[model samples]
Target: MTFLHSFEPGGVERVALRLHEAWRAQGRDARLVMGRTAGAMKREWPDLNKGGLGYEILGSERIPSSGWETLWMIIHLPRAIRRIRPDVLFCAGNSYTIVAVMMRVLLGKACPPVVAKISNDLTRSDLPAPARPFYRLWLRIQGRMLDRLVGMAPPMRAEIGTLMGADNARIAVIDDPSLAEADIQRLAAARAEARAAPQAPGRRFIAIGRLAAQKNFGLLIDAFARMAGEHDRLAIIGEGAARRALEAQIERLGLADKVRLPGHVSPLDAELAAADALVLSSEYEGVPAVVAEALAAGLPVVATRCSVSMEDMLGGGRFGLLVPVGDAAALAGAMSDIAKLKFDETAARDQSRRFTVEIASHRYLALMEDLARA
Candidate 1:
């Protein structure tokens, strides 16, 4: 049997890659067809030439295009599925979920079952006005066509089901299959090495993710500047169109020396392990992989209450501090509290274990098996 997987790069793509590897290891034929927008996947998984695995690119050359291009993704995707002709199709990421459901409806039973994994809570009425109609239509389509819908968190399951008008039984809550034991170990070693090396004694704060409006790193820099005297340094990883503007903000705040934008780095687990704390200033999120990784590494976290999952992930503020979105003062207060907060590595690791790749992979495999047999 063949399994076709689709996702754009970024955290979602990384999770999909792990699931693909797991499926391939199980002797199933798995092929990963990534959209051109998923540059991170193209860069990280260059070995797409291997047997039983294939990578097909779609969309425009620009990382994320606008207007007609985004809509055209729906047109191109169906053709791609017809070419692959797999027994089952697994779609990851929100964009891919919409696309997969459409394809399944168009292909009917000839296309095999389609499973769409949702990584975020979309039931909230906060979606941009212009996209709401299309978004609602897409969810309605998913309700009928999708064989199963997997959510990384329970809240997400409820949110997607409510929005799509789908049965609760059709939605399964599974942890994101990206945080593997080996990933944790590698991060631990990287942290140890960074500590043992002759690094400066400066207090470093690291934030990971694309430099987009949703990430809200601008607010993070402003908050960091308030504590500039206390913490010696700050770094925001990942890159996007907003990098230049963010750099300008750093300079305007006179924090050029204290702040650094390191672009994107691979194996961010090590970076999380080495940092004094992980600060998530996102305006929104699902179950952020970075937060889970930081918690696993025993790093204290300070994040905005962007989503219900954030509160759930942080153990209702027991694991870390939560600040209101866009409030620099609240963010500053949370950062100050981090200085006094102590984390138990064992407890943190235990919390993170709930989201391990193995557990998530098994859940996904079981769901797919059930769908295939049905």
Candidate 2:
């Protein structure tokens, strides 16, 4: 059996890499096709090459002003599919779902069973007009061709099912995976190392994600400023296009000393374990893997009610504090409450149990077995 995984950089890439390793460990022939930042991939995962995985870089050519990249992707997808000739194709990231459908259409019987992982909530009609039609078209096509649709959260499953006109029963909820027990121990040791060092003695808040508008780091910075004198420092990890704007905001808030933007942190589990609390200030999410990791470390989370998945992940405020989107005052209040908040560490760990790497891998393998038998 062969598994061909496609994903862009970010959380999807992280999850895909983990799944790839799991499949390979089980003696399945698995390869990863990366599109986006190959440089970042090398930096973040130096061991990828040593893992015996094949990679095909896409979207590298310069095109004209008419934004021919989309055309180019559609044009080149068929060739990539034919070359890979995988027994099963797993596409990660929402941006790549349409491409996966197109490839399946081009290959027909030669193509393997395609599974598109839906990682975002699509219930909201916030998508632009042009995107709505495109999404509909892709969904209509995928509904007939794709063998399975995978989602991390129930809300994501519902949204994708509704969009594709597929039965909800056809969609599978495979929660995002967590680190192995050994890796968790390593993470704990790393946290101990961070804690043992002679660092400043103030509340340390961390926001992890790209410095992009979608992450809404600007709102996080503004919220941090509201509690500027109360907390010693705030760290925003992950770099992106909005770095300069966030830097400007930090300078404007006069928080240069209090806030730091450490770019693209590898081994985030360590940093999360050391943090006083984990903050998710995104405009949207599909059951963020980082949130699960934070909870696994027993860290209190202060997040915006960014997505329906957040409601389920946080268990309606049982595990963490949830605030309204873009509301700095409410966020400041929630951040302050972290000192007095009595969170059940066992409950947090229990909630994160569903996302274990072992569980997700087995679930996916079972699904593949069923598909093969069918």
What local lDDT does model 2 show for residue 339? 68
Model 2 whole-model lDDT (C-alpha atoms): 0.72
**For each candidate, what TM-score against the reference?**
0.87, 0.86
Per-residue lDDT of model 1, residues 112-169, tens digit only: 6878887665653457789889988877877777878877876677777778878988
Error of 2 at 56 (Å): 4.6
| Model 1 spans > 4 angstroms off | 1-9, 37-40, 51-53, 57-73, 123-138, 196-202
Q: Output the lDDT of residue 306, model 2.
A: 79
**Which 10 consecutive positions of candidate 2 have the poorest summed lDDT?**
1-10
Q: After superposition, how far is residue 220 of candidate 2 from its true place, in Å?
A: 0.8
Q: List the residue pairs that clash in candidate 2.
A: none
Residue pairs in candidate 1 whose N, alpha carbon or C atoms collide under 3 angstroms: 9-38
